[model samples]
Target: MTLDLPLIWAGLIAFAVLAYVVLDGFDLGVGILFPLVQGEANKDEMMNSVAPVWDGNETWLVLGGGGLFAVFPLAYSIIMPALYAPIIIMLLALVFRGVAFEFRWKTRRGQFLWDWAFAFGSTVAAFAQGVALGALVQGIKVEGRAYAGGWWDWLTTFSLFTGAALVVGYALLGATWLILKTEDHVQRRAYTIAFWAAPLTLAMIGVVSLWTPFLHPLYVARWFGWPNILLAIPVPLLVLAAAYILLKGLTERRETSPFLAALSLFVLSFIGIGISFYPNIVPHSVTIWDAAAPDNSLSFLLVGAVVLVPLILGYTGYSYWVFRGKVKAVGGYH
Candidate 1:
């Protein structure tokens, strides 16, 4: 049997990225919801709900970045330069969010400022990630294995729209998580957000669906042309089904179902993205094959990856398992 290095690395990195989005996404959602939460008690409950696991959730992002650099150095070289600013902004925002989470408890005098920092940081980070996604989807400029676009080219109209939509999406995810982890007023608020956020999320997805094909002829030709159109039916159907279930779960106040249903939407959305941009790791400009590292390096990396990836997964799973249940306001940040 032949070893397909590019395909293997793509799958590995894609898994890491998806894991980060789904796990860290909900916690970021919690942070984004901070401004809307009125009571300090409720806010502490929200923070407690995710405090144990948010740090672990971010580990996948680091793994994804490292995997990309090791397995596809050229893609990393081109993409890092093209998206230098937003990437830095996203990282700094995450740092600020983390710091706020830590220091908000220690300093009572400046607690209000820290709370705002956490909420603002979360919103900015999520928006920056959405901008990154939109920029890639809109396509990057690559010339002779180098970045061809200007520094500000990443901020197009579509990218901005995508950023706003991600805020909604992350908000929905956060709401569902609160439903599972909180009770009383906080949980009710979460239920309400989940109910209203459903439509806005779907609408954003709808607009992106309409706008994405026009970005490149390949997307139009691949997804809507000939028999490929027929094959793409399940994606939308699954998304609609998940959304319906999410709405139903929220309405009924089911604890676990809402979170599971929301996760389904994210997973399916990623699957849709994979279908749209398969083989192309960097959208139109660079492909998995075009930017893939040498076979020997991939082989060496695989040895560490095969062992390291599973350990990370196991640790992450164990952490969640350890912290599973409702979050009560324990008076202070324990």
Candidate 2:
């Protein structure tokens, strides 16, 4: 039987995106929590907790984007133009956030500026990412293989709500991460933050779940229609289960479980999205087959991806393993 290159590539890209979200998300969440956390030492501990692995966590993002460009050029072409504004903002924010990571250590007098930059960059990056996701889910207007929507088409109430929702979601991730990686006051504050953020994140997830189906008829059919609904039912059930674990972990004062549960919620939500967008790389506008590059190109790229992806995974796992355990309050990996 012939290989289904497009489908394989789609799965690979999806996995990469999920890896990036789960791995890098907590660090970004930490940055978002920077404002709420006081004391230079507390912030230092927060930064130190993620410092060793934060940059490496972004490798999946590069892989996902590059895989899309090489394996699904049509989708990239359409999506880039459609999301140029938000994508650009996300990139800039990431640059600033990255700079803050290093420079914040170098300067004593200007350290506050870097702190603000880190927080601002992380928040904006997270928000832009969510906005881009919302705009895509809401549907990009594609005509004749090109984006036909106006420049401002992405700016909508739904998109704004999703952006805000992501901020809270990231904050939850950050708080849970802090609970896992810090001690004393930082851990206590994280517990307090998680208590509030967990409920808000769940409510936002519920709202977004309800609001998404109305954006397009295809989504309604995929989510609410017959056999598809059977598949769809488990997503929310799993989300509810995850939410319970998250709350229980927080209340019971378990450090690791809350973080794992928060990650599970994101995973469930992602799977729900995948269920909605199966077959269509650009939602209603483009199918995986229609948007894919030539088969020969895919086959060639697959060989490289097969080798590189595993190596990436191996090193990523090793880095985390090496850095595992609570971040000490004093000298650290940063």
Candidate 3:
């Protein structure tokens, strides 16, 4: 049997992107919630909670993007011109956020500036990502083999809404994370913020879910049409289940459950997206096979990915394990 190298590469890229979102998401959330959190000490705890593994979490982003460029060059070429603005903004925000993460510890007076920088950077990055996602989902304008859209084509009401939704979602993740990894007033505050954030996040998810299907006939058909409806129905049901767990965990004051539940929501949403975009790497325009590089290139890269992905998983898991438990009130990872 001929191995489906393109399909395999697509799955690998999808996993890498999901890993990046699941892992780096909370850390960005921590930054998003930075301003809402009062007191230098509380903020310290927030930063410290994610500091150990935050940078490491971005590895999957590198893997996902690099894999896309290498294994799906055609898709990359089309996507880059289409999303150049948001993608650049996201990268710059991440760079700024990283600089602030380190510099905040070194200076006493300038720390306030760094705090704002971190918050702004995280928010912008998350928003840009959501915008890019919305643009992609709305369908890129492709002419022949190239992106046909002009500059500012990516900016739309739907994309803006998705951007806001991602911000709220990330904030929810941050709040839930704090609930798990802090104590005293910080935890209490997290609970309060989460109480509000949870509902808003779910509402945003619902809006996006409803709004997405209308953007394209394919989406509408894939979601609500005929036999596809049978398969598609479970995503929202599972989202409800996850929401129940998240709310129950929050109400019950369970530390870890809420965080896990939040992650479940993201996972379910991602799966829903995959269901919509199956076979099409660039959506509407390009199939996985259509955009994929030659078989020889994919096979060569798969060998490296096989070795690399596991090492990333191992180290990432190890780091999280090592850093497990609450961050203390005094001092932090700098």
Colliding pairs, model 3:
none
Give a tens-digit lDDT track for model 3, residues 256-299: 99999999999999999998988799979899999999999999
- Give candidate 2's TM-score: 0.99
lDDT of 1 by residue, 17-107 (tens): 9999999999999999998888878988999999999999999999999999988999999889978888899999999999999999898
Deviation from native of the Cα of residue 154 in model 1, angstroms: 0.6
Q: After superposition, how far is residue 190 of candidate 2 from its true place, in Å?
A: 0.4
TM-score-better candidate, 2 vs 3: 2
Ranking by lDDT: 2, 3, 1
lDDT value, candidate 3, whole model? 0.92
**Residue 281 in candidate 3, Cα distance off native in Å:** 1.0
Using all chains and alpha carbons, the TM-scores for the candidates as numbered come to: 0.97, 0.99, 0.98
TM-score of 1: 0.97
User: Lowest-lDDT window of 10 residues in candidate 1?
Assistant: 325-334
Candidate 3 ranges beyond 4 A from true positions: 331-334
Give the root-mean-square deviation of each candidate in angstroms. 1.5, 1.1, 1.3
